[model samples]
Structure formats: C-alpha cells, structure tokens
Target: MKPEKLSDIKKELAGRTVQELTEICLRIAKYKKENKELLNYLLFDSDDPLLFSEKVKTFLEEDFKAMQKHYYHSTKSLRKILRIMNRYAKYTGNKQVEVEFSLWFCTNFLHYADLNTSHKPLQAIFIRQLEKISRLLPKLHEDLQFDYQGEFETLLHKADSQARWVSKSLYL
Candidate 1:
C-alpha cells in the first residue's frame, strides 16, 4: 500500500469504535500471518537463505515505512499504541521499526544456512523481546478501552502464548 493510502487508513481507523479497531487489527494480523507463511515456504523450499532474507528485509522496510507515515497525533490512545510498538522494536535489538525487516531476514538466513546452532542466543534474545512486547498488548488495549478491549486482550494473550510455544519449540 502507498504511504498516502496507509495514512488514510490510519485516519479512518482513528474514527472507528474500539470494536471496529479490533476487527481491523485482527485483519492486519491475518495478513501478517499469511505473508509470513508464504515467506516460510519460500525460504524453506528454495534453500536460498540470502534471497529470502533480502525479500523479508524489503517487506519489513515497507511495513515500517507505512507505520511511520501514520505518526501518532495528540491523542493519548494513539500515542500509547505507537509507543508500545516502538518499545517492542527497540527491545528486539531494532533501532527502528524497519529493523524488523532486517532481523527477519537474518533469522531466515540463519535457519537456511544451518547457522541456527550458532544463532541460538540471538534468536532467544529476539523471542524474549517479542514476549515482553506481547505481554504489553493487554495493557495497551486496556488504555484504549474500546468495547472490545477484553477481546483484544484475549487476542494478545493468545499471541503471547503462541510466541512462548514457538520459543520453546525452537530451543527444544
């Protein structure tokens, strides 16, 4: 999506009820999951970590740019959301949201290159940071307090649980 389009989406989102916002967020999550699944297939099947990493990096860069285009306004709720995402990115050794692109790139590369053994520490660090961010989602939803806040919190918890499962699976 173009930056202008994303900005328009953000504006539209701002006017929505909490329930609407939660629905939109769920859609976004679905999109991300679908994209990630496709990426995984490409990475694992192609046996080309470097190429996969480059593609992931490009995708992440675009996503970060889109997020940046929607700079939070003078609203506490919007500010909190942006802050949470920013902190999450920082905790994951990402200086900017765009860094997720690079990190994912590196992760795929490591996995394909059989570098996982050597990169376990880095992977653990990333997962821990993601966990922290996942834990903060409920607080963020509470602060926003739309009618579906509870449902959003539940979603966040599920995401956290899934993250924990993935972390343990990777280690084991």
Candidate 2:
C-alpha cells in the first residue's frame, strides 16, 4: 500500500494530543531498530550537535584503526564504516554535520586505507562519499561551503594522484 504524503502525515500528526503523539512515537520506535535509534537521538543526544559529531569522529577513528591493524575484510569493513557514518548523519539531521562527517570519513579512509585501485567496490564507496560531500556542500552556509570546498578539493586531488601515501602511523 502507498503511504500517505508527508503533508498529510503532518496534518494528521498536528491534530494529535501530546500524549497521543508520544504513544505513537514509542510504538513506532518499538518496531524498527533505526526508528528506535533516531528516537533516542532526538530524546537524549540532540542537545549538543558538536559533541555528537565529536563522539562519532572518535568512534570512526577507533574503527578505522582497528580495521587497518587487524581486519582483513576490506570491502565489508569499509561498507560498515560508511553505514555507521550515514546513520550518525541521519540522527543529527544537519547538513553541516553530514558534510563534516563525510569529510572526516574521506580523510580517514584516504589516510588509513589508501584504497587499492584494483578493489572496485572499495573505490566505489570512496567515490560515493565524495559525491555525498559534493551534494552536501551546497546545502551548508556560504562561508562554511567555501571552507569545505577547499577540503573537498584536497580530497579530490588525493584521489586523483596515483601515488598512495599510506601513513606509517596507524592512529589518525
């Protein structure tokens, strides 16, 4: 069955009382893991976006380090990392945070993985993230967009260079 349009859903929700809306939210959260995660973020983690992004950054750094040092599952690990980053972006619902997260992911991926050109899937994931960064840049404030654009350019150039500069230091 086709779902109702967003406007219709908004109208229906607008008519609901506070307790009724809370009940509906709780019921929805019970049915899906993602829904539950989003609800938790809204309820508890939405106060300080900078703090949330920093937490995500720290998590990403740790995961990337672990993958680099121990995990041999290249494509699988990269996909998992990207999925987590995307999920965090969804939680914040902020374009700036999304862009920052994407930038950090790309930076860390380049530094840690230096993705072998022969690995098509891994390369595709990197390219897809760059595309996401490009898409998100325009949605940011003009000054922020200009700043991120510089970083994005650096990443693009790094991707273009055939030479792989894998950092000897494992921790980024």
Candidate 3:
C-alpha cells in the first residue's frame, strides 16, 4: 500500500465538521480492524512463508494508512479541545495545566500507537518508556484529570514485565 499523503488528509479534514469527522473516525476504525484481520490470516494460515511475509508487509502498510486517517480525524477534536483550553486559560489566568495536559495527551497517544505497532521484542521497551511518562503525567499538575490512571499504569507495568521475562527466558 502506498503511504498516505498527510497534506491531503489534513486538507480533507480541514473542510469537515465535527460530526463528519467523528463519522470518518468510525469508518477508519472499521477499516483498521479489517486490515488487522487480514494480516492475522496471512501470518498464521499461509503455507508459503515468503508469500506470507510479503502479504504481511503489505497489510502493515495499509494499516499505517488507516492509522494516519484516524489520527487526522482525531486531530480535529484535539484542536478544538486546545482552542477551548486556550480561551479558558486566557480568562482564568492559568495556562500551565492546560498546556501540560495537551503535551501529555499528545505524547501518550503517540507512545500508545508506537507500543501497539512495535515488534514483540521492542514492544516492552516502548511500554516501559510509556509507563515512565504516564507516571510523570500526574506530577505535571494536580488539575489534570487522569481518569483510569491506575488501570493504565497496571497494564503498562504488566506488559513491560511480561515482555522482559519472555525475552530473558528466550536468552536463557
């Protein structure tokens, strides 16, 4: 699959309303699920490893495209949130928490994506880094609402620890 043109997606999203963008996000999620299913089939069911590898590579490319589309749609909501925060900050005279939240949100989202897409061996490393960042997020400010923080931290630590054990077990 050809790489998605970021500029084209940005242009398309720029003209769409919030409702339309949400609809597009749903469609993109559906497409991503379909792509993942196809990849799983190619990876696990094919007799020819070479052919399967090629198909998997193609599937990954398509998956990335879908991810780009979803990210583009999400950017619309993120921008709106940032705009509202900016306005609120201006009136309230407190921009630090809002800015920190925006930074944490963006970084966490990208790290989550990277962790999901990384190879099994490297996934643990990313997850560990994400966990560290997640911990720092709460320290950034007290005003930030980190809903499900406990659940996420637990999951991240579990994933990283399991992956590390697996890697070490293989080595031993």
Candidate 4:
C-alpha cells in the first residue's frame, strides 16, 4: 500500500488532541523497534546531542573491542555498527553529530583493527566513510568545518599509512 505524503500526515497529526497524539505515538512505537528508538531519542536524548554521541562512542568502543579478528567476521560487525551510527545520526538530524560519529568510527577502526590485509573491502569501508565526511564538511559552519577538517586530514594521513589500498591524494 502507498503511504500518505508527509504533508498529509502532518495535517492529520495537527488535528490530533494531545492524548490522541500520545496514543498514536505509542501505537507506532509498538510496531517497530526503530520507531521506538526514534521516539525515545526525541523525547529524552534530543536535548543533549553531545552527551548522546558520547554514549554512542562508548558503546562503539565496546563493540570494536568485541570484533573478531577474521576479515569476513569483522567486516560484518563493522557494517552493523555503522548502521547503528547512521540511525543515531538520522535521529538527531545534525551534521556535527554525524561528523563526530564518523570521525570516531574511522579513528577506532584504524587503531583497533590491523588494516594490513592484502584485500580491499575493509579498507573500502574506511575510505567510503572518509569520503562521506568530506562531502559533509562544507555544509557545516566555518568554525566546525575548520575544527573537523584538521581531524579529517589527520585521519586521511593515518588511513593512507595503514592500508595499502587507500591513496591520500584521492581524498585530499
């Protein structure tokens, strides 16, 4: 079935009473885990995005420590962690948070894993995330962009040295 447009949904929601909206939100939250998570973030965690991101960083640190040494297994877990980070970024709708998560992910990826593998898929993940951050940097405010650019450049240099496949010039 086709879903209603966002405008139509907004209009209908605007007509809802406070109790009705709460009931609707509860029903939606019960239908999906992601819906529940988004609601939780909006209601509670939305006030302090920096704090939320720090909690995520701590969670990711544990996840990274748990990652398997095998390339195939590590790749699967890494992508799963990436999905979680993406979800948090989507919930916040904040560019700085996304960049923060991306940088943290890349830094831990390089530090925790030995990217010295002869193949390229994991290196590809690292490179893709860096590219994603580079694309986002321009959209941020000048001070934030400058602050993050230094970190990004540092990641670039580290990535270039770690994985044989990544070329520093491509991202620069």
TM-score of each: 0.23, 0.78, 0.23, 0.95
Of candidate 1, the 10-residue stretch with the lowest lDDT total is 69-78
Per-residue lDDT of model 3, residues 128-171, tens digit only:
43544455555644534354354444444554554443232221
Judging by TM-score, tell me the better candidate of 1 and 4. Answer: 4
TM-score of 1: 0.23
Local distance difference test, candidate 3:
0.44
Query: Candidate 1: which stretches are off by over 4 Å?
Result: 1-118, 142-172
Local distance difference test values of all predictions, in order: 0.41, 0.78, 0.44, 0.90
RMSD of 1: 18.4
Clashes by residue pair, model 4: none
Per-candidate alpha-carbon RMSD to the true structure? 18.4, 5.4, 18.9, 1.1
After the best TM-score superposition of candidate 2, give how far the Cα of residue 157 lies from its true spot, in angstroms.
4.3
Whichever of 1 and 4 has more lDDT, that candidate is: 4
Ranking by lDDT: 4, 2, 3, 1
- Model 4: residues >4 Å from true position, as ranges? none
TM-score of 2: 0.78
Candidate 3 residues lying further than 4 Å off, grouped into runs, are 1-69, 107-172
List clash counts for every candidate, in order.
Answer: 0, 0, 0, 0
Error of 2 at 106 (Å): 1.0
Clashing pairs in 3: none
